[model samples]
Structure formats: C-alpha cells, structure tokens
Target: MKLPRMVYNQPEVVQPVRTDVLIMSPWLAPIVWDGTYNLGILNAQYRQRKFRVGITIFAIKKYTVFVKKFIESAEKYFMVGQKVTYYIFTDRASDIPVMNLAEGRSIAVLKVPSYPRWQDVSMRRMEMIRDSSHTRFSHEVDYLVCVDVDMTFNDEVGVEILSNLFGTLHPGMFGLPRDSYTYERNPQSEAYIPADEGDFYYAGGFFGGNTEEVYKLTNFCHKAMMVDKEKNIEAVWHDESYLNRYFLYHKPTKILSPEYLWDDNFGIPAFLKRRRFLAVPKNHDEIRNRR
Candidate 1:
C-alpha cells in the first residue's frame, strides 16, 4: 500500500502545531522534527493497516553484544504496536539473543560472511542490503530501516519516521556550516560534493525508506564504492560520504532529528532535551582493531 506524501509547508497562518520541529540552521534546512510528531495519532492511523516494516542491522564479530542490547531496547521501545521484523544479518546466527517479542513483532536471522577489517564490513553492508532487499526483504516487508547495531532505543521510534525516503541529521555535524561538513571533496570520486553545496550531512548509522527506495539507495552506494575502489580513492568517511552525496541530489521525503540517533557519549545539548536512541560508548580501538 502506498503511504501519503508528507507535506513540507503549510499556509503561514495555520501555524505548525508541533513544536519539536526546529529551524536552526542558516541553510534553513528542516533539521530536527522532535515534538512535531504525535505517535499516538500516527500509531492509530497505521496500526489497522498492518504495514510490514523491516529493521536491518549487521553485527559481525565483537558487535554481537551490541546487537543483543539493541534488540532488547528495540523490543521494548521501537515501534511497539506495529508489525515489525528485525532482519539480523550476522556472521554467527547462533549469537542472536532469544527474546519474547510482542504480538506483531519477530526476528529473522540471516548468515553473512565475516570480514577482517571493519571498513570492509561497513562498506559491504550496502552491497548486502541491496542484494538482500531484492532476494529476501522485498517479498516480506513494505518498508526498511537500516541502522548501526551500536545504538539502543531510549524512547518511541515508530511510524513517525516512515517516508518514501528519510535520513537523520548527523548530531555531530548538524550545527556546523555546510562548508564545514566532512563530505568527499576529491573531484575524482563519485561521492564528491563541493564545499558550497549540501543540505545536511546525514549520519551513516541510521536511515530508512520504503523497500524499493532503500534498495535503490543501497545499490547506488555499492556501485559508487566500486567505482572508487577501481581508482583507489576511498572517501574520507566511506559509505557515509556517499550517502551525503546521494541525499544532496535526491532530498529525503522526511528528515529525522538527531534525537533519532544521538551519541550519549557526547552528552545531550541544551536544544536536545529528548534523545530517542543513544549510541552507547564503545572502545573503538578494541571493537574495530580487534577484527
């Protein structure tokens, strides 16, 4: 079933009833939409429809512990009343934690090969998701939410985020000027974005959309990375740089606030009173270097 397209702007006099939507940046890009969404209303609207939503995560090697915490938090807080499926892509399917899911929620474990380097693991995720969306997910789910396993939900994460295409503002870069964004600057790479052009630097850790749109995004990123591989030109931030490039040309239908993917290690800012999911602090040296 096709979802309604979200209206970006309304008549000036009508006034936005939702105060969580922030217009802070000089670019005037709608960065955060926290209180703007009423999940109760959205839940009631979609609950009867029984939309099949797929949440995909990769937890190779040491990341298994994180997956456990993520799923625990997700089962309790993520899309609580909706029809949701956790598509866990892991090298060790046996490591997936067994949990009692709510009535309409379930888990699907798919085995993937382990990679030696974390960078390769991150880059290959795009290819795997793209291929699997066609082979596995498209047949089962209507929408797909791809996220990093290192985070856990702290509040409601429901249909408010659903759109034809959506991306979350990188909490670290949302306050920076467009030119300060860490976009791929090299002219030779397919992910290159000029310093002057960028709506927002979206986090690579979380993003989602309808199954078909997400498949297109993943496929595009995978192809771009391959082109960079041939030229021995890796973007400064790997797949993330490619994602920023993609959204610059094709703006997302909805832009989630940093609240959706915050880093608790950084502490909450004054403007951010509520954080939906927090990235638990991890010893990057240990997790990434061990592999």
Candidate 2:
C-alpha cells in the first residue's frame, strides 16, 4: 500500500491511511500457542472498531493447517472490507487450504527459509515489520503495533489513545508502569535499570508506536538480535527487552499507566486500578472486594 511520507514536526498535507495493526504469532498451532486466545479477543476488538487487521504467522510446514484455521476464523468476525494478511514464513510450499481461500481476498502467503528452532523464528516477524515500515509506508504509518499473538484487549483502543500517547509531552514507549516487587532482572548487564525512577515496566508482548518511532525501535532490536546471533545466544526474546530499554533511554516512548498493557501476575496496585481506568478480575475480585 502507498502511504504518505511523514516529516517530523511538520503536518502532512494528506491524512495517511492507517492500516490495520500488524500482529505476529510465530508458532505452528498459533491459536493454541502462547497468548493466542488473547490475540483472538484483541483481534475481534479491533475488528469491532472497523480497523483493518493484518496478521503474520510464522510457522513450520506442518503447522499451516492450524494457521489456515486461525485466519478463517478471524475473517468470519472481521468486517467485510476489513483486511487480513497472513504472511506465512516457512521452508517448503504450504499444503494447507489457505491459498484456496486467499484468491481475490486481501490475504496473501509468503514462504520464507526455515529456521533452526521455532523459538528463534521471530526473526521473520521482525523482517516483515521492518520491510513494511521501511518500504510500504515509507516509514510513515500512524501506529504500527507489534503485539504477541497472546495478548487480549479488554477495552477499545481508539485513536484517542494513540494521539494521547504520541502527542503527550512524554513521547516514549507506552506500557505498564514497573513495580519493584515483580521486576525481572534486567538482562542487559551493561544497561542499568534504575530502581524507583519510573512507575512503568513496559510489557513487550503488546506495544506499538508512532510508526517512525517504532521503525527506529524495531531497527534497534534487529541489530541487537544480530549481535546475539553472533554471540551464540539463540533465543533471547531480544525484541521485547530491546524495546523496553530503547524507550527507557531513548525517551521517545511515553511511560503511561499500566492499564494499557496489564499483566495478571504483576500489574498495577489494587488502589490504583480504578484511578488508571484498568480492570483486572483477580485484582478486583481479591484486592478490591476485600476492602
């Protein structure tokens, strides 16, 4: 698709078309994979808003069956004109029935070289986003979201949130504020995560951006992953962690309330839940009800 070229600090003459959010699910049976159900819920929510939804599935040859089923199910609920692109990355030609359904539809299949392990397969997803951002839109998309196939949306994320997050004074990574108790040890030995400096701990599984910023962030992640590859660190979840630190130091990602990207195990405090307009059943059922 041809997207408008964006100039920093300069308003565009034409309103760039906001393509559907791009979600990556790299696995054989993605629906049954991590956060797959949640992704379905979130995809349904996006379709409800009439937003175009494009999904890229990274899987092996045998797993094409499940991928086809997942795409068909998504198409059932999505609006008629709403688009869904299923970019399949695999070694051999796909035997699944996806191609039969894809003719004359927005959906398309792309077969890529196979990777050693399924976990290390995210490289394909990274490449897809990078290529799309750099070439397709000229790196000028309104919001290029990269969410794990597992995350579910509880509320409608309208243009308002995108405007607020990107237009706010603090334009950086938007995610759940970090808490001292649940902090995962920072993997970057060279990079020190200051304790108590900020309230947000970014969740990599669900994060997006002003397209330009996201491009930069993902570019950084790709480079970092390349380094890891050289160092023999095969599956480091580099994309997620790189994004967290990139915004932490780059400061383009605005640190926002945790509700935007909530975690059931470690998330916003009970008292702060309502304050932030976030609802978690466990937190509400246990923490608020007790009070």
Best by lDDT: 1
- Candidate 1 lDDT for residue 154: 93
Segments in model 2 whose C-alpha atoms lie over 4 Å from true places: 1-57, 60-105, 137-142, 150-199, 229-236, 251-291
The sequence of per-residue lDDT tens digits that candidate 1 reaches over residues 33-84 is: 6656555667667765758999999989888889878989998888877788
Clashing pairs in 1: 20-35
Q: What is the TM-score of each candidate against the true structure?
A: 0.90, 0.50
Model 2: lDDT of residue 210: 56
Clashes of each: 1, 13
What is the lDDT, from 0 to 100, of the residue 268 in candidate 1? 77
Error of 1 at 42 (Å): 1.4
Q: Any runs in candidate 1 off by more than 4 Å, and if so which?
A: 1-32
